[model samples]
Target: MSVHILIIDDEMNWIKTFSDILIDYQVCDAEDIFNATNLSDACEVLRNNAIDILFLDLNLGCESGQDAIQGLRAEFPNSTLVVMSGVTTGSIPLMCMERGAYDYLPKAMSTDELVLSIQKVISRVEHFDRVRFAPNDLSMVNTQLPFSSYVTQDEKLHSVFEYLKVVSMTQHPILITGESGVGKGVLAKAIAEYSRPNGPFVSLNVAGLDEQMFSDTLFGHTKGAYTNASSQRTGMIAKANGGTLFLDEIGDLSLSQQIKLLYFTQSGEYQRIGSDLIETSDAKIVFATNQNLIELIELGKFRKDLFYRLNTHHINIPPLRQRIGDIPLLIKKFVHQAAEDYAINVPHISDGLIELLKSYCYPGNVRELSSIVYNAVLKSDGQVLTFSDFEFPEIRDIESCSLNAEPETNDTSFKRLDDLFDEKIIDALRVSDGNQSKAASLLGVSQSTISRRLKKLQI
Candidate 1:
């Protein structure tokens, strides 16, 4: 898609020249914004389009263009603002900087300089979007693709979900561990949503955190505290104060950093680097990892004390291989997702193909399965998903089956209500690793149900 550029220049000749230059560089919708003499008019245009870059003139007729830019900057903060003018006043650039103008460009500069400035602005904006979720766009479902809606009929899967539902009501830290593609992150998000349905939930992988970036990203730094710090910033931990903070790949944390994190878990207090005052953080913490921390502790790579602190509520996500019966539902969901993403009609799946998928051992688990469906959607020439769309290794041994069970007649047996209830409660406890609230979500029941059941069962 072409980048949307909005130009606000009073000089008609300059506007025309710049529009031509932007068009030559493959930018789209390079429209004159000087027609928007007032903030209200500019805002109307901004609201109408997806603007990637805004070029604002420093002076509009009878109004300080800086003030107008400041107002537009507040409303369209995600759109990069580049100050463009024939007026070479230093104060204008400084003022625009204070109002969050992305960069300054002189009208007399060559086409190369203009294009380079735009490229730099685009790069910075993409990075900013990755780290920051705009409030307006936070809840909007991405129209490109849809993901699987969790389903449960298997006793083991249902029990785990029930446990997650219950533990989500509390503010305690939750630790989730499982093989990759086992939906550890998905489970973490489900817990966050249950805890604070109306609040923001922020997530990031802590595996890349070194000492400095971790501090700045989590606790936020004040202006002038660091060499390049230009403004006071809110960190992820601060941003999610009333909600939840999901730290994926927590097992990758270094031992020393784990000690630092332990302090936050212990006392709900944090201090920005180069600051003496301690600020309290009240966000619930959810950590996930595919690695076994016990092995890390054995090798002296992980801190035992920090592990215990985070282990107050634990969850273990089961791999897809253990839940082969779910493959059909998962594949159906992925096919619909692919159809939506690619703007194509949803294709039907054959029973032969479904049986073939169930027979194969998915090494990458659900993630791999989703990818296969996505590819099949793009490659399938017919309206239905058939075995021809798939390529698989020959079935080797009965032991090689994903479920580790011999192929037999479809089992539709059921337990008595009492036995079913007991089994579900126990399975919830196992998946939650004994965390009651998280167990509740997995079971599609309220925390009270699990609590009351536990009381009756005396578990």
Candidate 2:
């Protein structure tokens, strides 16, 4: 994408060199006051130039670059401003970025670094575009505590959260399936809160555990079981008795451990590592995995019986790309939380910036979002985060549809059938207060259809 960049510096030599380095992009320069007699004239130049980006020097003669940034931001809200300065670090760049500079660069930067920064800015803008315009249906059930400061506008995520509230009320084992960083742990914790607010909520990542350790850690030993067993020890399952037990990456459990887990799940009973006697714990089990268990079962990596047992009540999280609409909401939520955590003011988001985030595929999902916002907040140093804080991946390798184009297929075609589908379903569900059968009947659809559609669309 060729972006029109406006250079608002007074140095003729540096401006010429800067424009030369930006040969891959379109650069417009205002080298001296003669080019723009006054602030109004400068604003007029920016207004008429149809500029996408601004490279403003810190010293703009008697007029400071700070004033120009503020003026241009007010005049051209869509333009992404870049603050370039010979002076390193301090309040000026912060003020510039806070006022709405897309990025800040040292005037002495190498041609390569300068070009890279510009490309990064362009990539972010593109990513945001891909996510902002997609449609979704978002709902808020009773917000649970430890109330996931993790933000996502993704309708699918909201629905998962809503379903999590209801599923949390039961002791049925929950199988959470998703790609890594889709907030499975958050969902598990939310379920734990729902099960027993005051009871113990213990979580174990079963990924690295061996057979003996897995059994021992889950079911406590009664003194003298092993060489290290100097005294009786309570395991996580026992510790979580009457509460929730979360097993993360349960797909990583060995076959033997899977059998042991299945036995306990089936009968609510387990045996410690060296004990013959059976012990029972009434803890609710919630397991999460990024793996496809069906494939795992077919490959003989995961046990079929265990998969079925854990999947009694399942929650599959959609990835970031599927829920593009959630990008801005998540970004806004993250910015606010980051500002609060860092004791800084919340930053403003540019429309182009929003479009940039939506365009990229967040392979790391919501966790990536948190990291990006946190880093951006640190870089901003109390200023608003610009496209500069966000580092985009190489765009040449990404698929076009995942970047700039609208999704060719709306797999959730049921949503497109009619707007009434949403209104009727939501209205019935609300009036019935989450009675599936009643809601289905009210909508004149079979209960099975309602269940099937909800499972398919994950709403």
* Candidate 1, RMSD to the unseen true structure: 22.6
Q: Write the per-residue lDDT of candidate 2 for residues 1-459, one digit (tens) a residue.
A: 445666777777876677776664442233311233245555777767756666778787787777777777777866667778898754555455546566678988887787788776665444433333334222544233443543555655665665565556666788888888878888778777766888888999989988778878889887999898999888998899999999999888889888888998998888776689888888989899998777677678888668656764678887777777778888887888888999987766555456655655666778887788777877777765554566533232225346344333334422332343544455556666778886665544677876776776678
* Model 2 RMSD in angstroms: 25.5
Error of 2 at 168 (Å): 2.5
* Worst 10 contiguous positions by lDDT, candidate 1: 139-148
**lDDT tens readout by residue for model 1, 1-459:** 456777776666777787787767864444422334444565677898877777888777666677777777778866877788776643455456546665667888889988887776776555455434544332222211121135433555554454454456656688888888777777677777767767778998988889888888888888889798988888888898888899889888887788878999889899887678889978989998989876687688888677766765567767677787788988888898899888888887755446545655565678778888888877764366644455332223324443654323233332244554556566656656788775665544677988898888887
Q: Residue 25: error of model 2 in Å?
A: 77
Compared with the true structure, the alpha-carbon lDDT of candidate 1 equals 0.69
**Model 2 stretches astray by more than 4 angstroms:** 1-139, 142-150, 392-396, 400-459
